[model samples]
Target: MKKLYIFVLVLLSWNLQGQGLPGLGAGTTPNNKPILHGKSWVAITGKPLGASAGATIFNQGGNAVDAACAMIAATSTMWDVLSWGGETQALIYNPHTKKVIAINALGYAPTGATVDFYKSQGMDYPPQYGPLAATTPGTPGGIMTMLAEYGTMSLEQILKPSMDLAKGYPLEAQTANAMEAQKARIKQWPYSKKIFLPHLGEEREAPEVGEIFVQEDLYETLSKLVEAEKNALAEGKSRKEAIYAAYDRFYKGDIAKEIVRGTREQGGLFTESDLANWKVKIEEPLHVNYKGIDVYKLQEWTQGPALLQSLNILENFDLKSMGYNSANYIHTLYQAMSLAFADRDFYYGDPAFVDSPMEGLLSKEYAKERAKLIKEINDPKIGPGDPYPFQGGTNPYSDILNQNKEALASLPADQLNSSLDPAFIEAFQSGTTSVETADAEGWVVSVTPSGGWIPAVVAGNTGVGLSQRMQSFVLDENLNPYNLPEPGKRPRVTLTPSLALKDGKPMLAFAVQGGDSQDQNLLQLFLNMVEFGMDVQEATEAANINSYQMQSSFGNHEVRPGAIVLRKDTPAWVNKELVDRGYQIELWNKTSGPLNAIWFDWKHGSFWGGSSDYGDDYGIAW
Candidate 1:
């Protein structure tokens, strides 16, 4: 009997240590929502309707890829801070190929979007709204491509939920209020005014909460896509070819014509050739092995590699020993993030346009060298390091690096120490939404889709919103030479989706929104699970620290050196320790995130889905 008791106690201790439940040394609160467990499938996204769309697809005998596409379509149609005109970036873990791939559906700058043109217009950066700020649409192409390549469902079946929604759905209070708040901007676009404001002359022009918001134009546009697919299928085209037929219709056929005409009518720079030529790229994703797990991210075009770099640096420390959310752990993470983001600000851009030295930047040796620079106190003046040497190449932009350092050094002391500007915070935490889906069939997808949020300019009668992603570009080469506002060049964006594998099997699929803070929140979420052993739910809803040390990807591209955001419930001792370390701390009731994740519980052969408490993020599991 004593032996039996000892055996049970040992088993309990192991489970607690491995799971990191409450009171098991993991600094996480009781999850606001319980973890969703599923043996067959799970769908989680930014909105309930979006999750339901994915669940509907799963119920109809679809894989994770199909469900994810459905969720993307549904969320885009619902205007969940994104629309069909926005860009999509996804990381898909294919169960058959046993490999992860990246979907690069980011739109490039349209015709006449050169830095010289913006300079001639007396603007330092692209306009923030309206036609002048739009990029060529990419979401339609992205959804079609993913569906054709890995999905096992017809385009009609996959898009039906969203099509039904485009006709009309009960408007949520959050989206309704957002439209009302930006009604003036929506009114500026004739097509948007026609759809968004039902009672223009009244106190509330936007639709009321729970009102059946009808979008006839959007419904018609979606119908065109389905019609194209149906026509191709009737003509004896294969399933993949039929999907491509829909893709071509959106990118190169009548739909493209309407989009270009509508954009031009609103003073936008889109041309017929621009729409016809833009295509989605399916490429091998980048990965770095930390410990025994392989972590994957999209290429240099996004802020993804920053997370990998942080992992490489943090791998050098014993994070589990440091305790979760401890002052030392937080400082280490901040320093590592600052170092990685410093490199991102200077080196990350479209690989087609710039040699970003990614091979060297992700090297463990390079991370070790960068990690050595982290001191006890915060270093607000940290600048990008020369990664060329690590790659066995000479730094071509050495002078630019020095200039950037000098410019940062020249900033006023007060500006560096001041609290985060409201404008800056708003832009830094700008728009986006995430979709995470998994199935028993072994397919998993993580997507971060954004642009064309509220206040977007709807393109004429097409009912498609124009992407405001052009504002991510910098007009001056000094800011980011590789990401200059050149026509046909893709902008370096903050959208990122993450996947990880352990023992050559899917371990976690996760993503989040919040523009520049995407990777910051993602990094913490990852560490919370892997290092601290918190379950998917606790890790996602757990409080995280946000560092404003890197340059913002939106608005004026400003940076707030040494600024840190902590949860209001953070211990006072922790705050004192950080302030003593030369940090400017702000305590918010909530840190920025609505992170969604699916943890593949290989031991139990099930999936654990987590949708953070913030926002309307929801999930379904069975």
Candidate 2:
């Protein structure tokens, strides 16, 4: 009541003019540093405008889910890579019900995307970019669903910020950098080049850091959806029905048809059925008790469970006693994550298609048995451990695991070409957005929205986007236990979001955007906060480390066994020690990008917003 009391006074003094009461709290922080904190409903989002949009929503009587929808709307429009026509996943915690709901909006393969289709094309795998790589988008439906089920605001209100952003907005430094880095992909599509490569100072180039970038088509696209909702309202439909009307405009109406026409005309194998049949699945969230704190993650379809599995193994050790970021700590994280990710490479996929052995995979007893396999020295390769065998059941993935091992055994490490080069990593580094929100009433949401970008051909004249995530599917069914290309099956993605609860109360929500780095960076940031006693802001500002030891989820599925990267600021001795231990170590430049999270102090009835100092990450707490 005390913190809430102070928050009321702050909000009471606040207005809609973008002004703040300074003495009451440090409501915001500058870029390239820590972050701001306060005792109120807070928004930590990918960009400043997104955060501001959330703050406005919160002040206007919206709940956390409403604010989350508003922030994502702004994020999708501002960053082309973290697009409107993309994939998304979210974990929402309901305090009253003590239930955490998982929203999986990641797109699925079109009916035409199948092993036989790839075989007929003489393609070993789905191409990494363009129309050939598209999947049925899920973001539009996901956002609308969130608004319909959980949000308080209407589609028109939440979408207003995005409409403004798409029609015209100043290009931030982060987007400018993305435009420059993904220049080649942008050039491949006239629609993208026209939007992103606007002429600056008499030269056609990536927009200068603060120049304006406009997407007239995108503005029209979003407006059309809103028009549908408004028309439904005018016809005396319920608010929820109006939201559904808006969703239909994108999923089954003219927009969806236009998207199908555009992609198929550009050689994409898609039909209206793919878009109409698309639906976001809501399921129970996966949870694990980590050192008495409950942690929630997406299911096995994502690389999410790896974080929990790693926690289970690491729980056996005294991490604080080992000293933070020590050689022992780093080695242990590497080994544990390696083992979990081996399982990820072999077992993680659309659960509808594969038996993931979820019961054993999440059991503490299984983690104990698997921990015995971690050696004192690092192992370049590990097992897709037989979770079912450990749990005294039949292992469904056994045959596929054995086949994958045999395939790798036949290919020498030196001859294996990886797709995780400078260019590929740079493309990922350019994209994605995350939002974390917590309201005074205790509703919380952590969402990681990603995929659609410049590389994919635009969706016809609709001024919309489609995902290139079909490449995440597998070519050889034997090598991919759960990720074989199948109609209506979601791809095994790296888009994992994390939620933390203290003593049965929701405490923290977080997500990141570096493809495979999503889990690694998030795992590190979580440990930084919970294990090393760092605040949310310092946890993000802290230097990061990552590994590419597992076969990538993206194109080519290359394995960079035992490869590890650390930021230069990490102690030189730690790098030398890891190298001495036979792990391939590369120094990362500026580590990871724009990781966002929010922590709620239930005891104080306060909320704290945090973000990485990198990119355009910003926080608003008032």
Candidate 3:
């Protein structure tokens, strides 16, 4: 009853509040009493309630790292897109220390996972079974790591808000819609259905905005962690043990058994040993110098290298002179992306398994070699480039041959006739709910947590389909494996979280949530803020575009026609230039991505942040 009362009060408060920004979905509300007086934070998630979860942490005196963890936990409950059981990567900036740290919270393949092992089982590759496909979730590991290194608040204190919210809260329309969309699968998992389907035996419409939504099992799970933490503290258990215990409950205890059993029964490959041996790897971040700014990016294991390459190519062009979002500007950006992506397909991979010279690849000299390919004024239909020989020679046809082989191999032998069709190539361009925040104490964080292409609907996991991440692999033209299967290799991913600094201080903290569009959106937003001198709000409001017309570093080799997509709100002059550039223009009804950003204006001595009002729910606080 008390819980119901508190929920009602929150609902009332929500109704009375004014909406925050334009692109930030429906539930955002601005708080005048900023959490950081001279500092600001922007958090973007798949749902509004999720952003609020993190904002609450900021209000409770937690720093940006804490806020990021809180937001991730909250979003796991509400969005179900990515959860604690998924991969996580982050870039944290500590202004006081004047240092930036990268956290690779990506899960490793199980010890039992080997290329030969799959062949022995008569399966060509490891299947995407929920259990088999599940990597040890890195979100929890990453969060704990950050908390231990930088956060001031205790784990229990930091997690309280998420725990409370998980006990029960009013379901929103978006969440309810997702539930309905995956109803059949939810009904399969009795435990999941128990939490998601409260109506049970009775027929009823899905729970609405104000109705209570509870996940008792999840609550119990979290409660056990809290209790274990307390008990460990009392029993003199080391901090590592307490953390391990909390993680054990999910991966090695009852939950682990359930996951293992489910996978085994489904003929999956995840073994108990796999769970026991999993550990997160910490590696150096990929950094590049762009226009006098030292830009830091994640390594090749993710799509970070692509952004580095794109920036390098962009630096070759006079982008500002071309004008922001103008046809010339967009064309140059697309061309740069194309050249960079071409290199990405052939070279980017796990450094441990593949001899990918990521450092050399991102070097200024390499950028210079790649930049020479871009024309200053002419925009041809940009194509991919060949990988530079490790021995330092050019092999112009190497990438083309490799890409053709990959395309042919991916198709079934019987369907090989249509395998190399250009139409099919263009279909691949389709592809993060990200979070960013900075506290007054100078702790800044950017996180991109994602699970792509839902696999088979897991029975009883509340229509919560697992990620078919295995599809991210790349193959050769004759269908031979180019990026050979290897255990513990981080698949080339599109999710990259970024931070920008000026004058040795955290100037702009930004991230974009869109697969291939991430770097494109980030580039646009950066230019909007730095070149055009737009404020956070205006920068966010500015319309931007992306393309499948370009090739990428990963296996997405489709080159789309000259089609440029723009927000309906873009000015007529911008549209005219796009048409003049021979682009078939398409207007996106809702902005395509949720780009959340916060900037520190040294000149004004103030902090400003804004969230996109796109199809995402985002918020900002200072």
Candidate 4:
């Protein structure tokens, strides 16, 4: 009996140890990380390294806007996969004004770029193809604009941390992994290779955790910008000239010329004139009403409108009554997503070029018509409906056909016998990285920066990357303008940052990294919070399901896999329901993209924050 008691005691002790704390000492989950003080606003991002940069700014008496500026600079250096000399968009919710102001830091295609240029080169546009595809980088300008207008600190103060970190910092595992993945591409650009490579020529082992990684040129660039900021303030230099000088030095001066020469030699279209003519435009964000609340999106130039359209379709359904993640709930969400994507593919584009009837599309009458079509397609296999008619012409079916053909042609020729040929890349395109913050005063900001498929990485310069963003044109067979490209015209973008307001107050500031998944993830995050009433952590960590079985925004006919991907922690019952709803449910051990979010609880006057648990190491602070 004594021996039995000892055995039982040991078993009990083991169980107690197992249950002591969920993520304690695990170092893998945010749940284990310490929470910050309640009143202080917390910023979350994909990397803790990047989050630390923002947190430092906040700790140093910076306001939410200042913190955002710091975060953007840090991300450009650390999270280069989704950041860097890319485009950016921001939505600021000002409690004082009780209004949301938007900054369209999105880069525009240069006036000189045209489809004919690519055709003349006898080369097809590769998705990841460089410098010729880049638009003017808008991130730096956007940061400066936001800081000068809404922030409390000077550019020098906001950028100091980023500059220091760039000079030398230990590479985290995530950054190292990304560097290795793009090692080949990094090698192609001398400046990139110098910073990312070990010994400057040969591929070296990734820096161990805590080992310092340095980018002296990037540091110099940040320093130059800071110096220019000071000069602008002290030397009577115009803000425009200072901003132009900073960007010009990075792009057109030495770095940009190298990139232009290299790309032109390789049959790319980037020109000196394109660089000189490039500018970031500030435009009005698209707004729609949902549940009597005003929701703003980044206008027709990006996929932001899809979020509104999805919400409109969802408004027709009783999501709250359906039970969160239930078969009915998931089905309704998927249906709404399908309808919105249909419109996104057919209509959404650079509004300056495409006559996207913003009002007609968001109108209840149009939404009802679209919703009825969604109901008609119960099979889930049926794709999007015809686009709404314009003044004289019907829906643009030919464009859809062309996009579909291009997607099909992109398929690997070796996969002729394969049953599953990806009509388009399942992964998101036009990568966007985001930052979110809400202060005690109720000022909330969500900013997303993105520019991809722009062959902008100038050779020999770590400071500048030229964008090749002019390829999004609708043209005739003769390579003439079906839609003529124009200056200051915002191109089709995927980066969109959003804010959730409840009763005229900021509830949460959220954004995701995937190109198309940005809106889908945002929608799911909203449902997880509002309908399911899950805490911020659970909602972000919850399993998500998306369909490739339909047409994507770029007009790729995705074979709807009807698959549902859930975080490993998802409840078994939720899985059963998803399967019952005809979803090919797959449980992912870990997903890649990070969803950054912060929640403001008015009832408790406390703030709760959470970031992606998939792999990113992020935390909150007082």
Q: Which candidate is the best by lDDT?
A: 1
Tens-place lDDT per residue, model 3, 1-622, is 9999988866665543321112222224443222223444545455677778777787787778888887877776554356545667888887676888888877655546556665676654444334555454566667666776677666787677668777788877756765665557556544445655666665553455668877665566567667766777788877656665666665566656655555555545556665555665655677776766666777777766777788877777777676666667777776677677655655666666666656556766777777787664323333344445423766534655566646644645343121223344323332347777777667778888765222233322322224434435443322222344556655566678887776688777777766666777777777766665555655665567765554332233344455556777666886776667656666776543667777776776666766766655567565
Write the residue-wise lDDT of candidate 2 on 1-622 in tens digits.
9999987866654421111112233334332564556665878887788888888888888889988888888887876366777888999998788889999998888877888898798888887788778888788888899989988889898888888878778887767876777777867776666666776344547888767778898898899989999999999998899999989889888898888888888788779998898888998878899888899999987889999888888888788767667788889888888888887777778887777787888888889888888887777657677788666798765677777677767766565442346755653343567888888777899998877765546778766667878877888866565788888888888888889998778878998877777888888888877877666776776677777777777767767776777777667788888888878777766675578888776667787667886666778887
User: Could you tell me how far off, in angstroms, the CA of residue 149 lies in candidate 4 after the best superposition?
Assistant: 1.4
Superior by TM-score: candidate 1 or candidate 3? 1
Regarding TM-score, does 2 or 3 come out ahead? 2
Cα RMSD of all models vs. native, in order, equals 3.5, 7.4, 9.6, 6.6
Candidate 1 residue-wise lDDT, 1-622, digit = tens: 9999987876675545433344533433346798999999999999999999999999999999999999999999999999999999999998888999999999999888899998998998898888989989999999999999999899999999999998889999989999998998888888889988998899999999999998888888889999999999999999999999999998888888988888888789999899888889998889999889999999999999999999998989999988877899889999999999999988888887787899899999999999999999998988988888888998888899899899988977776754787788988999799999999989999999988898889887877888999988888878777788777888899999999999999999999999889999999998888877788887888789999999999888888888999998778999999999988898887774899999998888999999998789999999
Tell me the lDDT of candidate 2: 0.78
Q: Which scores higher on lDDT, 1 or 3?
A: 1
Q: After superposition, how far is residue 170 of candidate 2 from its true place, in Å?
A: 1.1
How many clashes does each candidate structure show, in the order listed?
0, 0, 26, 19
Candidate 3: residue 459 lDDT (0-100): 21
Q: List the residue pairs that clash in candidate 1.
A: none
- Choose 3 or 4, whichever is better by lDDT: 4
Lowest-scoring 10 consecutive residues by lDDT in candidate 4? 19-28
Prediction 4 TM-score vs. true:
0.81
Would you list the rank order by lDDT, best first? 1, 2, 4, 3
Worst 10 residues of 3 by lDDT: 18-27
